[model samples]
Target: MKILLANPRGFCAGVNMAIQCLEECVRMFGDNIHVYHEIVHNKYVVERFTKLGVRFVDEVSDVPEGAILVYSAHGVSPAIRQQARDRKLQTIDATCPLVTKVHMEAIRYARQGYNIVLIGHEGHDEVVGTMGEAPESITLVDTPEDVEKLSFAPDAKLAYLTQTTLSVEEAGRLIAKLKERYPQIESPPKEDICYATTNRQHAVAQLTERADVVLVLGSQNSSNSQRLKEIAKSLGRPAYLIDGAGEIQEDWFTEDNNVLITAGASAPEVVVQEVVNYLKTTFNAELEEVVTREEHVTFPLPKELRQLQLSN
Candidate 1:
């Protein structure tokens, strides 16, 4: 069996920065670290941090007053920040700069009196945080069908923002629909989808063409991971999204099949290697790597963590 592994498949710069921030928090403050949400969307990462005594809370109220609370890479709404402030939490923001850029765009559009249409999945942490920036002014739409149901005057000012982790193809289709519906609609100054997401999806798109089956390693809740699976399945290939090698189904594999393996931006390379090792041992698979793009982007650790390092 031949295994096609995708380069640029895992651990984007933002995820790296968030994970490092949490690690530094653990080292500096030990068990006192509390994160607002899953640092990224990988289960293994959250579990590892939990094992290290870091608390993950969906609500700010769950965190003890005045505790050291770190925002997740998904970023939080202003209200959540205010809540933390009210509780006197020592906040360390690990929000990805790309995500932050979307937030700023949302705020900017809202301030300009343009009704913002946020293109993202409902109830997603990133979407929720972004909508919270200007709830009254922002509308969430995941599909072209949702756009049809939107109620806005023909002459109303409008702007669109997108989730950073969205599939490039899916978002493009949605944007096309939006533009068709509102000829004068405004787009973000730049693409809101992060470069990491685009690169990983592009890598998967290139590899899936030659493979009989595709395996994407990431948590179910991970948006980018889900997009990768969708991209493969959309191409009529049988695709599976697994958190790790243990979730891999032997039934899906055959001696004659060529399998493609890729991982989400937040998924660790170690997990990808685990899947590769299992395939190699179980099927004697010959690995062929397909490099779609080279990525060198990096985000700095949170300012609070950097100052702590400097003080030491």
Candidate 2:
């Protein structure tokens, strides 16, 4: 069996900055820190921070007053930010700059009087926060079916924005459908989809076309990881979105089959190495990186963290 790994598959700059912010906070504040959510949605990364005494909480109310509270890389609504301030919690925003850009677009569109269609999974943290930006004006759509069901007033102007980590091809198809339905709909002036997502998906596209089986490394909640599996399956290849090597099934490796290994943005590189090493040692499979894109994007530490780092 052959193992094809995708370059630029794991840990985008936003995830890097968020994790680093937590690490630095742990170093600066010692064992007393709280994060608003999973720092970047990967279990391994969350578990690592938890082990270092970074307590994770879902609501700002759950966090004690005067505690240093860090927002996840997914970003949050304006209300959450205000809530943090009301509690006097030291706020460290680890929002991916790309996600922040989308938030700005949502606010701008709402201010411009256009009913917005946010293309993303409904319950996703990013979507939930974005929808909150202009709750009354923004409607959610997760699939082509949702597109067909759209019933905005004929006189209502429309614009669309997407969750940052969505499948590029799927979003493109949905956007095409929307344009056909509403020829005058205004799209986001810029692509809200992050470069990391597009690059990783492009890499997976190259791999899935050549491999018989595709294994995407990511948490179940990881949007981009799920999309990688979708891209592979859409091409008529069997695929699995496993968190790590332990989830790999022995029956998946056919005698002469090729397997492609790729990871989500939030996934750790070590996990990919573990999976690749396991495959090679167990099945004597050879591994090669399918180079599709080179990612050099690096988001800085959260604004607060940068200040704190500068002080000491």
Candidate 3:
């Protein structure tokens, strides 16, 4: 068997910042950390933190008063931030900078009298939080079907925004439809799909082209990772989302299969190593790395943690 490891597969700047924030929070404040949601929608990351005493909650009401509460990197609605303030919880905002950009655009466009249209999956954590930014002005559209159903005053000033992680092709198709319907509508100055997500998806797509089977290393709920898997599956290639090496079903690999391996933005590289090691032992696989993208993005750690490190 031959194994292909994709470049730029896991751990984007946002996920890196989020994980660092949690580590810093634990070190500075001790393990009584309360995160608003799964830090990055990856079960492995969350489970590892849980073992270290990090508390994960879906609602602000469940958080203990005066505890250190964190918003996930996926970002949160303004309402959520207000709720944390009302509860008197010590708060840390770990929202990804890119997601924050989209939220800001929603606010700016709404205030400028433009009706807002957001392209993202409804109910997604990021979408839900972003929607909260201009709830009265924004309408969510996920598909071409939704675009077709869109009905608004022809003369209404309008603008569009997008979720940070989305299928580029799908979003393009929708944008084209929107343009056709409202030739005068305004679009975001830039696409909201982050560079990391786009680069990783492109890498996964490239690797899957020559690979007999593609394996995506990501949590089930990771939007970027799931999109990578779908990109492969959409091409009629076999794909799977494995939490780790232990979840790799042997049945998916035949004796001569060439496997392509890619990790989601939230997945850790250590898991990829484990998967490769497992395949090496079981099938005597030879490894070849395919580089589609290189990433050097980094976000600074929270100030409180940085100060502690300096003091230490």
**Which numbered prediction scores highest in TM-score against the true structure?**
1
Cα RMSD for predicted model 2: 1.2
Q: Candidate 3 regions off by >4 Å?
A: 303-312
Task: Tell me how far the alpha carbon of residue 285 in candidate 2 is from the true structure, in angstroms, after superposition.
Answer: 1.7
Name model 2 segments beyond 4 Å from true. Answer: none
The 0-to-1 C-alpha lDDT of every candidate, in the order given, reads: 0.94, 0.89, 0.89
Between prediction 1 and prediction 2, the one with superior lDDT is 1
TM-score of each: 0.98, 0.97, 0.96
User: Model 3, range 1-312, lDDT digits (tens) per residue?
Assistant: 999899988899999999998988888777889999898988889999999999999999999888889899999998998999898988888889999899999999989999998999988999999999989999999989998988887777889898998988878888899888888889888889999999988997777878999989998888888899999999889999989999988999987999999988999999999999999999999999988867888988766556657877
lDDT of 3: 0.89
Which residue pairs collide, candidate 1?
A: none
TM-score of 2: 0.97
Off by over 4 Å in 1: none
Task: Tell how far residue 283 is off in model 1, in angstroms.
Answer: 0.6
| RMSD (Å) of each candidate, 1 decimal | 0.9, 1.2, 1.5
| Model 1 TM-score (2 dp) | 0.98
